[model samples]
Target: MTRPLTVALVAGGALLARRALRRRIGASPLWPMPALEEPVSGRRRENRRPSSHRVLVAERTEPAEGVVRLRLEGADLPPWEPGAHIDVVLPSGAVRQYSLCGDPDDRGAYTIATRVLEGGRGGSRELRERLHEGTEMEIRGPRNRFPLVAAPSYLFVAGGIGITPLLPMVRAAERAGADWRLMYCGRSRASMPFLDELEQAGADGGRVTVVAEDESGPPGLAFLGGLPAETAVYCCGPEGLMDAVSGALGEARAPHLERFTASAAVPGGAFALELRRSGRVLTVPADRSVLSVVRDELPNVSYSCTQGFCGTCRQRVLEGEIDHRDELLTDAEREDSMLICVSRCRGGRLVLDL
Candidate 1:
């Protein structure tokens, strides 16, 4: 069952369409990818303590070069939607987010994959070097920011390991019999994970287009602007690729984006922060993040990704207006809480439930 049930099944002389999509991860060549954080875009949230579950790494395999897929088995595991991501708490207490590239129908286990970033942060390197089968770890959230919506048609663009999140979306789109096209890009065909499965999915027609850099110079995105107004476009990959797709779309439409890293926030004015419980007041400089200033006051503040996508630095706002910046939180979440990493205060002062 490690091979995701991407293909549909027929029974009783009728077609049985499953709602869950076949999730897969492809490890591509050594692309200059900084962070493979899940697609945390169009994120909606409600304030709740997302529970953490204990799981054991039941199996490990190399789906492609520079990639490792881990099947974590846990009894009565929670179900996840397409484009959902789980937060892994490493042995070093470093938290990293990864997309769930497994059959959501199989709730007993969860599958995720990662690409080793040799020159970047140690999160992926730790997963590759330190983790193995039989190892126990903790996972959190199963939160979905990049959810597949009901669209007239879909145009999915994935680059390198960025295909992780879109895998489930592609599956769901096919199952729904929606008009969808996928442009999967990577370093080479040999390095792309789940190529055979994708090829098979699109075998009946030309639904999937593979763009290997070695074979194709670069992806031509001018056609995106020519798409129909009803087409829902989704793009996940390197910042430059996503930016290019956005650029091509121009004023026609804004494609739903899944980012590996956090987006840069505009520079806002400095403000004073009052930690209610800690009885501390700090000034958040315009140039620095609120997290940097808060950490100085309380050295052990729990935070990861420091870019606001992870929501680790979220603090309840007791008073004052917030200059919200992160894409991970929703409108309701902005009512009482704010991600201290990038968000700031609209007023000159504020009170926080730290």
Candidate 2:
């Protein structure tokens, strides 16, 4: 098993708010977006898939305490949907993913935000220190595994920095004239990003519930039971909140949500692992993860968020039927690559590209 992460804040969830509203969704009636694995921009995934592009840190701002918003600018950038995210490759070789929170119509740049977790992983700290206005770095993808779909109505719930992804969705829902509401919760009002914007946007039309644990206890999620199942619920927040909502609504009526952390399942028996590059054979015991065992021999292997939410630990599969356990990878990515931090062999031995 991976070691326990000392995440200080109560924000313990992955960015997993993927609710395909089961119909065509568009910001305006002019552009009718179809509900599919990709956006309705007519850009094919493989044909337009870019390598890495150098982007300048054009702008940076602290929207809230411990949260940084960066505007990475480049020329003729690819278009993205509301829930898309990009992989930021750092100078230190550490890779981190951030949801694109900016306007999708603005194709010249991408905007992303992150919250620094004290005593947690090091990516956010490195990003804050190394990145500055005019600094150039390589970034890949505006990949969308969580694109917004057409729904009769939407209920957006955000926790702390989790609002990054939902911000665009809220805007789209509002602009599209679809029925929607927001429930934004955080440690305090000062800790929540995009608070004023969300409040202003939701002020005249719909409900925008702001629950601060400092003043009010945990907000009651029991109202989910009364809502129509057709109401597409998009939730991105703490793990406990997601669990509470899911438990109350049940799996059949599951709320669409996102996670910032990995959820490890029951480990199977021991298995053999083959590293084709380094020519090393290792045994991954039942209680351990493949990442822990491989790191012993190959100390320089890149890894962050050992929970498997980040794509840093992904490796090519030379051979083996992998028991995939990560939410970071899409169906196409899972065809050959697997996140070593959580995935394991189905049975017997597995071969990797090291």
Candidate 3:
């Protein structure tokens, strides 16, 4: 009886030791467990993916007659690349994205230029009319979709307010001693923001052309025709100009365009969107945005920029087709999913991954 009891005790001790060893091995870095073993509680997990920062208005300057350059002061500003934009959450909770035109090397602050649109939405209007220096506002991201790609040479074209994103890229190119040229166009010099800086940067006899419509008439299609085959053309501007450029370029010489407005005028239609996880289907009116519909139906959903510039309200498409109107998603992403903020269903019915 004593031998049997001793044998059982030894077997039990070995089993416990083995379990401890297994636990230690699992906890080891070599095993590598996920940071969160379980799903984070609530929609906070989704909300946390897109980070937000607060910035104080440091200064405001009128670089041009209609353009207002805003300098924001914040130590916690996220590291951003050239061509990055931040979503500014205004006093009325309206979110709008502005390109970071400031020098990327300048860690002190981020700067953006806004052209007040008389008939446009309230975001830019509020900044122009109501907001001022020392005003505190919430800003999310230095998110960049229009990143500078490595090329042998570059051809940059800007129209009016579109120069904002390209400014940093131009500076970076200058710093790197890369081969590049810029064609900046506006109504006139007075309406062109950062004209002095642009002129000074090109003073070393760098290839930079200024085309004021009032002075030089509309920039001819020939301006783009002069680009070398080895050059990558990066353009940002109004729809008509972009469309003209797009029409002129062949497959071999297509200019990479960054559109300021995410949405174009699509035919108005009513649609039903099915949220898979939420198990809700909401009707989206022709006039209302998908973000409004989603937020109304599912109160827990989080969104920052409803204009589709920020990837905050991005959702996967499970079924049906989408008319993508967002700038954040790449061609592949747009093909795969939809930005619920601005994009809508095409076929009257759509399914989404909540």
Candidate 4:
């Protein structure tokens, strides 16, 4: 008489079962595959060594009241998509990224525009005042992570300078003969760049809506309810506008978002990090970053932006859980490495393969 407790499978069968289970787990969609490179601002860094090229400002003009447009020309310049951006190495060693707004087919030059922010970082002001026509500057990249995906219809939301990236997508959609609509909002008509162009596109009963805050205040969120079920939505704007759009769409159909702004740091206690090869330990304070502390020990380590947007400060994590705060690394990359500029330790002690 066989009992249920005494039943057993053959060793070979048990081994096959385990292997099949592993295969199924690996095939799961939730299982993250390693990204070839880190993604920044809804775009990924390509799996290639970056090279810098000198570009001349062929033309510069005030497209709007406080917005400046620049046509940067370089020899054999790489083409870019609507949502692609390039890093400009400023004269003062400050690196800033700007979206390519011009025609992608035009390989000789790239067009970019920036709105001056009086109360924000000085990069915009510096570019507006110092960089003139014929000014030569070094630039890196033309990466796109906010690429437009095919769908039956589309919705785009742009706020002020955020329109730079979406402008190209609109053109692409128009050329494809796809149904699309745009909700462009700004403080005023005079301050909005490309107002004339966008206005002209919507003139013959087109699908464009311009909401100037001075005239209509904040646009009502009721339009979100009327979107087609299969419409692909893209939004690049202020946090408030993005948040509102997200809330309206809900988790079921959230729009693809592009952010030039970094999210606020997570509130947590300070921690310590150990550099394995250097045999050095440093206490990271809440007020500072691991990059800053690490620089104190290894001053020559390369870093750029220092805001976790650029993958320049990525480091290997040998041991310990990470409190990832950057919008860069994917889950697979997070398993063994971290962007030291923004991420912190989930535990009290961290071991870095420095």
Q: CA lDDT of each candidate?
A: 0.78, 0.78, 0.74, 0.77
Please provide, for model 3 over 250-280, each residue's C-alpha lDDT reduced to its tens digit, 9 standing for 90 to 100. Answer: 6566787889776575765998888889888
- Model 1 lDDT tens row, 1-354: 012112122332122222121111111110112345465475633356457899999999999889899999997678777888888988888888888887777888998988888997789999998889999999887877787765456788899888888888888677656667788888888778777888799776578888888886788887776676666789999999999999999976799888988786777888899999999999888898888898998989889877766777888888899888786775656787989888889999989887
- Model 1 spans with C-alpha error above 4 angstroms: 1-47
Question: What shift in Å separates residue 63 of candidate 3 from its native position after superposition?
Answer: 0.8
Ranking by TM-score: 1, 2, 4, 3
TM-score of each: 0.85, 0.81, 0.76, 0.80
3 or 4, greater by lDDT: 4
Model 4: residue 225 alpha-carbon error in angstroms: 2.9
How does residue 294 of candidate 3 score in lDDT? 82
lDDT per residue (tens digit) for residues 87-185 in model 4: 887787777888899988788999999998888778888898889998999888776657776555668889889999899888766655555678888
Q: Name the best candidate (by TM-score).
A: 1
> In model 1, how large is the Cα lDDT of residue 14?
21
- Descending-lDDT candidate ranking: 1, 2, 4, 3
- List residue ranges in candidate 3 displaced over 4 A: 1-49, 263-272, 281-307, 310-313, 316-323, 330-337, 345-349
User: On a 0 to 100 scale, what is the lDDT of residue 58 in model 1?
Assistant: 96
